[model samples]
Target: MSVHFKKKAANAQTAIPTASLPDIIFMLLIFFMVTTVLRETTVQVRTILPQAEAIEKIEQKRLVTYVYIGPKKLQNNQVGETAIQIDDALVDEVTNVRTIMYNKLTEQPRLIVSLRVDESSEMGKVIDVQQELREAGTLRINYSSKRDIEGTL
Candidate 1:
């Protein structure tokens, strides 16, 4: 019996299986969708920003912290007394601002506290908050204001 020797083909083409490509893509999309964070703070107080002739916009928003000061909006379209808001919570006591700001300062050393005070709000409260901020050693403050449309016109 004579046995025939067969030579294996050197140029064998191998293809990457893409059958699970769609499944892998779907899983990755779901993973990103689930992990992504949408950061929009629910503002408790209503702020009517005062118009300013000259206003400088903040470029690095991540380094800024907002403190909203305005009249508390009550039920039935009624407005209550002036209130201080930080993030989503209302400041129970003015003194607490110092500690809160100090903690925030530690977290971000270059923290810029942006005061979003309403037009009708009193300066005394603003000054009080400023004092508390000063006590906290957070001196970099930006008064958030809307640009004067009349000036542009």
Candidate 2:
């Protein structure tokens, strides 16, 4: 007798069971959103900071002292070129800056004095302030700068 061939039906595909994929991705996103650390940024009067070819990263938050330089009026009531202002008063000499900085350093020995001198400040004044800080045993000093988005120093 001639053999009769029977056609076999194709088997149906197994279910992928992808219902947990969205849940898994959503859980991961929530985990990262909760566990990620966001750094706190310093805010103050905006000033155009001098650019540096080499910039170093500041890892820790320490005590900051702002030294502002703006227009000043002499005893004669005549407005003169900007002078360094420490805590709102005019800093006519290095001694004033030194005394204020020294007091701050004493309170926080590990203070990182952030010098925010104006762009128009005299280089000599800036150096003088730095020298005084060095003399007062405040070695850790940072110059605040405005950074561009490209990450250029």
> Best-fitting candidate, measured by lDDT?
1
Q: Per-residue CA lDDT of candidate 1, range 1-153, in tens?
A: 233556656886698889999999999999999777578777777799999977798988789999999999888877889999998899989999999999999999999999999999999999999999999999999999988987855
Positional deviation of residue 91's Cα in model 2 after best superposition, in angstroms: 2.1
Candidate 2 lDDT over 34-89, as tens digits, reads 77756543322234476664667666644656665444545554446756766545
- Give the TM-scores of the predictions, in the order they appear: 0.74, 0.54
The backbone clash count of each candidate, in order, is 0, 0
Residue 102 of model 2 has an lDDT of 82
Clashing pairs in 1: none
How well does candidate 1 match the true structure in TM-score terms?
0.74
- When summed lDDT is taken over every stretch of 10 residues in candidate 1, the lowest stretch is 1-10
